[model samples]
Structures are given as C-alpha cells and as structure tokens.
Target chain A: MLDSALSVFRMGRNMARLMEGLGVTLEISVVAVGLSLIFGVPLGLMMAGSNRPLKWLLRGYLEFVRVMPILALLFIFYYSLSKFWNINLSALTVSIFVFTLWGAAEMGDLVRGAVTSLPRHQWDSARALGLSEGQVSFRVIIPQAIRRLLPGVINLTTRMIKTTPFVFFINLPDLLKVGQQIVEVSGLRYPLASVWVYGFIFIIYFVICYPISLFSRYLERRWAS
Target chain B: MRRARFLIVALALALAMIVSVKAQAGDLDDIKAAGKIRIAVFGDKPPFGFIDENGANQGYDVYLAKRLVTDLFGSPDKVEWVLVEAASRIEVLQANKADLVLANFTVTAERATQVDFAKPYMKVALGVASPKSALISKVEDLKGKTLIVTKGTTSDTYFSKNHPEIKLLKFDQNTEAFNALRDGRAAGLAHDNTFLFAWTKDNVNFVTGIDFLGDEDTIAPAVKKGQTQLLAWVSERIEKLIAEGFFEKAYAATLAPAFGPAVDPKSVLIEKLN
Candidate 1:
C-alpha cells in the first residue's frame, strides 16, 4: 500500500524525492483548476449574457471538451503542434493548455447555468439600488454563485489529480511513472509490486482530493444551514 | 475511511490480476511458421515504424522488418506490423498477436528470459538527461536525484543495479519517459544514449553525460522462446547487416539527421565464433 513512497524510503533518497513527485501532481491539478475557474467564469458570464451566436458557440465548445477524452485531446495538441509547426512546447505548457481548455469549458458551463439560475430578483434589487449591470453581476450575483463554484473547483481538482496519469501519455513522469520505475528497478518478482506502487498513488490522490471534497462539503453544509 | 479502504483493496486486487495475466509466457515459432511475424512496434517512435503521410508504416524498424520478411520467405509481403505500447509489447508478443518484437527492444536478463533476443542492431549505453533547470554535469551529481525510464528497457536494469539509491520515474513508453524529463516531472531521464541523443539533440541546452554506466549494449529484435531457426536467422541477418553496413546506410539515410552522424560501421559489427 505504501509502495509509492516505499522505493524512495527503501532506496534512502532524500525526502524531497517523495515530495517532488507529489508536487508535480499537485502543480498540474492546482494550475488546471485555477485556470479553468478564471477563464471559465468569464466565459460562463459571456455565455449567459451574450447573444444567440455567442451562447451557441460557447455551449458547443464546452460540450466538446467535456465529452471528449482528455488523452486524445492531449495527443492532438502535443503531436500536431510540435510536429507540424516545430514548436517545441514544454510538457508543462501542453498539460496546462489541454487542461485549461478542458477546465475552462466545464467552468464556463457551470458559471453559465449558475448565473442563469439566479432569480431575476437578484439583478432587479441591484438595479433598484441604482447599481449598474456590472455591479449587479459582481456585487450581487457572483458573491452568491462563488459558493456554488467552490464545490465545482474542488471536484475538478480531484478529477485532475486522478487523470494526471494521462500525463504519462505525453511523457510527463507524474506519480504513475514513478510506480512503473520502482517496478523496473526493484525487480522483486511480485506482480503485486505495481499494486503496491499504484495503490499508494491512488491513496496520495485520495488524500489530497478527499480533503478538498470534505471542505467543499463542509462549506456547503455550513452555508446551507 | 472504512469504505475507502475496501475500495482501494478491491481496486488493487483487480489490477494485480490484470498485470499477472499480461506477464505470462510467449511463443515465437508458432507465430513465424504461421507464415507472418507479427511485430510490436511504436507507431510514433521516430526512426522506427511510425505512420507516415500515406498512412503506411515507415521508419528504420519497418525498413528492417521488410528485410526480415524477405529473409523469412524471400518476400516482403509476408510480414505484419502490429502497433504496440510500452506496457503491451511483452503482452502482445506473449499473446501471439505479435510473433517477435523488433520495436527498439532492449536486451536485459529479466526481459531476455521473457522473450529471446537476437544480435542487437544498435549499440548504446544508459544515459542521464537533465533539463536546463537541473543541468546535470556529473554522475555523482545525480546521486540523490530522481530519473525516469521506460519500463522493460535496459535503463531500468542499468539504473537498478548501478544507482540503487536514486529515485526513478518509470513510464510505459519513450514518449512518457521523455515527457517526464521534458516537463521537470523528473530530474533526469535514463535510456539508451542513442535515443537520448536522438530525442534531446534538438534541445540545445541539454547534453549527454560522458560517464558511461557500463559496457555498451546493443538493441536487437526479440522473438519468443524456442524459435531456434528464427532466432538464429535473425541473429545471423543482424550480424550480416552490421557487417554489410546496412545500419550505417540506414542511419545515414534516416536517423543521422536526428541523432547526428552514425557510428563507424566496423565498430558496431560483432564477430561470431563457433
């Protein structure tokens, strides 16, 4: 179960090694979720407030990223851009680019739905207070909707952590890469080694994710009550 | 906590079963005498069989496979190229989907027993690749740093025995291992110096360390166990090809651009003794 950190501990490498692998996974998850929320909020606002063409386009793009597999999306970006244009994009850039596209779309849709779901009274009262449309969004609607967005942000992060393994596809040696490496080096003849390595990986993912999730749930309960 | 623990255990059991099933025995003669050698090759590994514009397989391995097919039945048409992955190469060969693997198969004792190796076509030693951020200049500099390599390749063994204390990030394919190194996911990547040379040659900042970990090893097409005629044939052809400068010519024509000039033809040829 502890195999993910076992090799590092057993090998007697510095504690930094374990922290480093975990860091990459966290970095990808945090950045992807942060960007998704940043770009998604604005896009969602636009989707909700804009004309038919804008709404349809935003909706379509969101549906596309949401439905398509992240692995395929990563490959299309990594191989196509680098090979055709000879653009040597760092793996970090590619990961961020794909995840942002995915994150933004999901975030945008959530924003769109949340904004639209708000009773017209929220906007009416803001205008009644002589506030502008922008103020109505920023001062009134968003303050409330942010609570809703928090849960989504938490959910996105958990999903991102689990999917970080896909980074292996683009050659990012995230946690899963470490597991495969330990097996290669240890060579203990246990098919169970991968289990130990990956089993530990899943735990790391869960430990990080569960707290975010519990916090989101806690906030929800506290706010709901 | 209780439910999550159960779920983790359940998932572990399921995955262990799958890995064991894939690591089972492989056969080679049955695949060849069936008239075609199904090979597991990388569809994206360059200078190897990768899909070209016409959707036809092209690259060094594909070119060599054509020779193997011709050598097998005196015709190029008798071969089938089956695209496989870092994790599936052994499984594919074992399952009889691929008769032998010519797809940059690295020869290691553990892997050697799983499937037999012929004469190595290319010679290389394990290398350590560090990004600009890390800029590793010496072997001991890598003392505590983590390194990444593809599973089942020579680097896995090389690093295991040589740098037991070092951290490793092992992936299923060259792409993943390279990506890990490229993205600062791992401090360095461990693999054949040829691949490191070919892969990192484009990046000006990255350079291969001069310290060779051990004796230079060769990469050869591997077939399953007990294919005496087939393994002998492949070994002989590989040796002959090395002597005749097929790899040199092939490297000159294809890989030299990516990996720099090919090593001298005479240097790579192996002499066989009875």
Candidate 2:
C-alpha cells in the first residue's frame, strides 16, 4: 500500500510539477490579495463615508458579485469577454483579474464592516482635535480598523488561495490541475495513483493555509490582550 | 461627488480601452509576423494528446502540432502549446486564444459551423468500453443503462440525441469519465474507438466490446471561422504531410506503442484525404 502511494512521486518530475503548480496558485493568490488590499481599503472607506450615489454603485457591484458564481465569472472573463469585446486576455491574466475583482469586493465589505463597527467616539474625538476628515480617517479610524480587519484579511487570503483551483476550468495549470494531470498519467501504471496524488494535494493545501489560519488566530489573541 | 465622478471617468476609460482593442483572427501572415503559432491540444486525453511524466506534451496530436510548427517556422520552438479541456476547444478558437486546435478534435457539421476544419489526419468513431463482467456489446444492451461520456464529446451528443433511453452521466474531463467507469458508477464508458482501444489495453479489467458506433468521423486541426488563409495553409500542410507519410511515422512512434502490435495502423490513420 505504501509502495503504491509513493509510486506517484517516483514518476518523472511529478514533485517538481506539483511545486510549479503550487507556485502558480501562490502567484495568483498573492497578486489578487495584494491588489484587493490596495484597492479595497479605499473603496471600503468610501463606502463608509457619506457618499450616496457612490455607495449605491458600490453596493450594486458588490451585490452583483455576491449573486454571481465565481465559476461563471471565470467563464465569462476567460471566454466570453474576448469573444464579445475583442480583447484577448491570457488565461492567467483572466484568472488574476477575476480573483482580484472577487477578492476586492469581499475585502471591501470586510473593511466596511470593521470600520463601521468601531466606537463612534473615536471618530468624533479625532475630529474634535481640529483634525481634518482625511486626518481623522488615516490617523485615528484606520489604525483601529486594521486591528479588527487583519484577521479577516488573512482569512480572505486563504479563501483566495483555496479558490485558485477553479482556474483549472479555464485551463490554467494550478496545483489541483497538476495533481489531476499526475493522477491521469500515473493511473495507467498504478491503480492507486489518484488516492496518493489527491491526498498529497490535500496535505499541500493544508500546509499552506494552516499557518496563515494560525497567524490569524494569533493576531486575534494578541489584539484581544 | 468629485470622487464618484473620477471613478466613473476611470471606468469609462477602461471600457473604452477594452473596446478599442480589436480582436484579429490569426491568418498565415499574422502567424508568420508573430513568429509563433499558438496550437491548442488536450492535456488529459491519452494516446492522442497528453502530458508525459516529464511535464512535457507527448502524444500523436502533440507530435503533429510540433511538426506543423517546425514546417511553418523552420523550428519547433516557435509553437506555444495551449493546453485545453474538451469543452473549451471551440471556445479557444472563437476567443482567438489559440491559432489552431489539433486536440483530437473530431469533425462534425455542428462544429464546422463554429470553426473551419482542415483535411483530416485521423478517423474515429464512438466506442463503448465496459467491464468484462457485464460487457456492453451493442446499442440494445445499453437500453435503460447509464453510460458515462465526457461532455462536449461526440459520445455525449450521440447518446443524448439518438440513444436517449440510455441514461448518461457526463463529466467535463476524460479522466473523470474513466474514473466514474472504474468505480462502477456506470454500465459503460463511450468515447472514440481509437482511444478506447488504447485505454482497454492498459486496463485489463475492461474491454471495448462495441468497437464502433455512429457515423465515422474525421479528426482534423481547426482554425477560427473565417480564417481562410490559415485554413488554406493547414489544408496544404496536411496534404504535404500525407504525401510524405508523416502521419504513418507519427503513428509508429506514438500510437503503435500505446496500441500494441495487434491493432493495425491503417485502421485509424488517414493517409489520404478525399
């Protein structure tokens, strides 16, 4: 049983291919998450502020994203966008674009929740000190919001990482794709190949996501104290 | 209000940029000017197009794709291999993501309307591979029985249209269909006879009892619809390859090894196109 389990890795560059796939997964997750933080924080601040039409527009966008499935979004951007709009983005580019759009929306909502949940006096006090609105936002409100939002951000990062496997549908060779490829080829030789390959992939995902999850918990505890 | 206006302007500009970039179908000149041909091939289906253990593409379709690239550019390295799933083969062409699709793409009237196919290099027909214990040898035997087929494949279309009584379980990937068959979730798995023959050889427990079904179909490379120049070039290249016995050589190297000596090469190979 053990021999059969180890046989998948004995195949040519299977481990290396898995590593390459992991790299792709991380690449998409990191870029999407980074871009989400960059764009989403400001978008969230706007949503929290007194901007009526802007809030309505942002809410519409967020609700649309929430209602639409990620898989459908991927298919739209990867296939339909090019066909209808005549703009051909590569599969990798499309995956990143879709993920960033999704991540940004989720992050924006989380940030809005974090900022809005804070005590109202913190904002009033900052404004009472003769600080401008921008100063009150950047100096007083944001710092406190970060403490509340970091754990959620890390959770989003993990969610984005996990969702990267959906790129396989669009033909991006992410981690699960590489695993499927390995299982397909190796199944010819070893009947137990899928068990080993999928089990390994499951472990790889856990190893990557667990630490980030741990760090989130650690921050929650640290900030609670 | 100012920020909202700015945001609206930014989105409008982005939309304008996207609209302004016209999608151009890659013709012979475009491919030559680009100095590379993007060819789509399957990453999972074996004996036709599959990635080897070395993480490099190895299969009959991949071999043909490489040769086509070499002949066009005088070097094999000028080809960008776009791995595709069965369902996305036509989508890739329509989207201009791939210049040609040589991914065991069986020719059909419905598909021809979407993408122009060159002369065929191989011929195929649907076949059913079932467990030896309860072998399915004929269409009548499959009545009321569940059959596994890959979505967007000829088998799926055939079973759905003609054999509606035979319940079908469809999967997006070839590997998943085979897995369903192995796990005894279905009575039989139907795919191209050429593929089933090769597959049954590796899998001793299964046998391709029904070796041929439906009308005989030709498998050929396809370019985006209206890409007349590329389509002409591909047709000419296929004739040249046939005259030189390139497919026979490819068969000997790739398919023969997978099929073993019992299977005749001429049965599946299309040496001359009418």
Candidate 3:
C-alpha cells in the first residue's frame, strides 16, 4: 500500500502535464454547456407553451439526441463528415458541436419539465395582475422555474465534463486521454502504473464532480428557504 | 412455474456451452482442422496493413499473412483478418483471439516474454517527422516540444526512455498521431522509418529529419506463447518466404507504390533469422 501510494505521489508531480489536458477539457465543456443553455432556454420556453407544431418538432429533436449516444454522434460529425464529404473539422470544434447539441436537448427538456409542471393557477394569477404575457413569463414564471432549473443544469455540466473524454476518439488531447498515454508509457517501468494513473484520474474526477454535488445541495437548500 | 423453471435450466445450459466454447484455445492441429487462421493486422497503417477504398485489406503485412495461410492451408482464402490498432495487437494475441499477428509488429526482448516471435521478415528503425512550417530540423529541436507517437508502439517506449524532458502525446491509433501532427497539437511525429518516409512522401508538407533514434527493430510475426509447434511452423514459413524473395515481392506490390521507384525492397528485407 505504501509503495503504491509513493508511485501515485510520483505521478502527481507530473500533474502539470495532465493540467494542460484538463485545460482543453474545461474549455470545451464550458463553451459547449454555456452555449447549450443560451439556445436551450428559449427553445424550452417555447416548448412549454402551447405551440403545437413547434412542440412536435422539438419532441423529435429531443428524442433523437436522448437516444443517440454521444460517441456515435462525435464519430458521425468527425469521421463521416470528413471522409464521405470533403468537410474536415477540428476535433475541438466537433466535440463542442456534439456536446452543444446534447446539452441543448437535455437542458431544453429540463426547462420544459420545470416550466410545465407549475400549477396552472400561477399563470392565471400572473395575467390577473394585468401583466403582458411576455412580462409575466420573463418576470414571474421564469424566475420560479430557474430555481428548479439550477440543480439540473449543474448536474448536466458535470456530465458534460465527464463526457469530454470522448474527444479522444477524434484525437483531442483531453485529460483522460493524457492519463491513458502516461499509463501506456510508464507501464514499462512501474508495474503498478495503471493503478497510479487511473487512481489519480478517478480522484481528479471526484474532486471536480463532488464540489458540484455539494453546490447543488447548497442551491437546493437556499432555494427551498 | 414448472415449465418456466425447465426453460431457465435449458437457457443456463446453453449459455454454459457458449462460454466454454469461446474459452477453448486453438493449437496448430485445431487450426488445421478448422481450415482457417485468424491473424491480427493494422487496419489504418499504409504499406503495412490497411483497408483500401474497395474495403480490401492490402499491405505488406496482409500479403505476408496471405502467403502464410496459402502455404499452410493450400489456399489464401482460409484466413480471417482481425483489424487491430498498435495497442490492441498484443492483447489480441494474449487473449488467443488471433492465431498470428502480422502487423508491422516490432520484435523486442521485453515483448518476447509475452508472445513468441518468428524469424523477422523485415527490419525498420525509429524516425521522426515534423511539419515544414515548424522549426524542428533535428533531434535538439524536439527538446521542449511535444512529440506525438502511437501508444503501445516501439516509438512510445523509445521516446519515454530516451527523452524525459520532451513532452510526449500518445494516441491509440496511427491516424490520430498523424492527425495530431497536421493539427499542430504536436511539434513532430515519430514512428518506424519506413512509415515516416512513406507518410512524408505522400504528405509533402512534412519533412523527416535525417536523425534516426533507437536501434533497428526487426519486424516479425508474433504468436501466442507456449504454442511451440505453431511458432516453429511460422518460423520455418518465414525462412521459406525469405529464401523465395517473398518480402521483396510484397514490397513491390504494396510499399513500392508509396515509396519512390528508387526504393529497394532488399533494403528492408531480412534474409536470415537471428
């Protein structure tokens, strides 16, 4: 146990190398998730309202995004686009594109659920106050819905961070891919290299996601009060 | 309830049979009886083993494998090509999923313990290539730059041991390493000299430095350990092929197209086993 711990510590010294990879992962995830919410919120608000054809169109998109695995989508946009057509895209661009689509669908669905689940009387009372439909939604209903949306959005952001490893398929030097590279090379000298490298990756992921979970809890409590 | 129990028992027995069948390993006799040989080869790497536009597996390694199957089973049709990347080649052999691995598989003392290697059919050395726009002209240029290499390859092991100061980015596939170089993610890409040469020839934008690192690695067919009969069979077959100038013929067929007309097949071919 002590020997393994020492190896893990030794590996940690090279955390700077892994940090470069983490930078890429964080940048991609933040942009993808941020853009997803920007576009998704409006689409969700539209879906929540009774726009018959729009709802049906959004339902199909949401179902397709939900059912399709992120890896498959990444490949379609990365390999097939470049191979069949002459359209070559950078790995980072393809990853952000796929994740944005994924995040939009997921975020849109969460917003729809939060918006539609409120008691029907909340809308009637907002309109009863002589507020415009747009003003009622923007000021009253959306504010209440946001509190409910916060936890889901934070959870999705964590998911986005975790899924960033799939960028390796398209040759992006993301965190998990870097760890895999280190493990591959170092396995020659240290028999326990995988244990060390993968253990550190696990810890790094926990360090990232655990805080989000705590923040979500804090948000839930603050919003509840 | 009784009928359902009977059905469950039948399903359990069927599952047991399938698992046991898969667990059964093949020897030379079993391979002969089955009339088919499963060989693992690289699917993306050109001049070695790659799938062409017609979806046909064509390359030097593929040709050698076809020749081996022809000599063994009296026809080249009795072969199954399992496409493997650099990292998965050894795993496929160790798992007993492949009867032979004819990928541009390098022979090393460390790898010998995991699998038995036959007499080498070809020889190659590690070489480096960088984009034309990049200032990396020699080995010293790579001092602070990131070097790209395929994971589980000899290049990966070579750089990791020799150059600790240089940042290394390893990819699971050769195409990924090549892509990394083109994308400017890494300053240079390192691999076998023949592969680097071929790649640089096709991609005029990149140039290979004159410096070659590491020892000349002999490319040989690898078989699962403890398969003495199979190993001896492959070794003898390689010796026969070498005597017949089979490697030269394969080079003419696959590598000659990528490499210029002046490229000699004899330069890479090994006539005798060490």
> lDDT per residue, candidate 2, B1-274, as tens digits?
9999999999999878766564345688989999999999988777788888899998999999999999899999998889899889999988888999999888889999899999999988889999999999899999989999999887999889998888999999988999899999999999988988898888889998888789899999999988898999889999999988999999999999887765767768885745
Deviation from native of the Cα of residue B69 in model 2, angstroms: 1.1
| Runs off by more than 4 Å, candidate 3 | A1-13, B1-274
lDDT score of residue B3 within candidate 3: 100
By descending DockQ, how would the candidates be arranged?
A: 2, 1, 3
Looking at model 1, residue B80 earns an lDDT score of 70
Q: Give me the candidate number with maximum TM-score.
A: 2
Query: Measured by TM-score, how close is model 3 to the native structure?
Result: 0.49
Candidate 1 C-alpha lDDT tens digits along B36-105? 6666666556666554422356677787888777877788888777665666566444444456787877
Better of 1 and 2 by lDDT: 2
TM-score comparison, 1 vs 2, better candidate: 2
Model 2 Cα lDDT, one tens digit per residue, A45-135: 8888789999999999899888999999999998898888776788889899999999899889999999999999998898889999889
TM-score of each: 0.48, 0.86, 0.49
User: Chain A TM-scores, all candidates?
Assistant: 0.87, 0.94, 0.91
Q: Flag regions of model 1 displaced more than 4 Å.
A: A1-8, A12-18, A189-192, B1-274
Per-candidate local distance difference test: 0.69, 0.89, 0.80
Q: Candidates' DockQ values?
A: 0.02, 0.58, 0.02
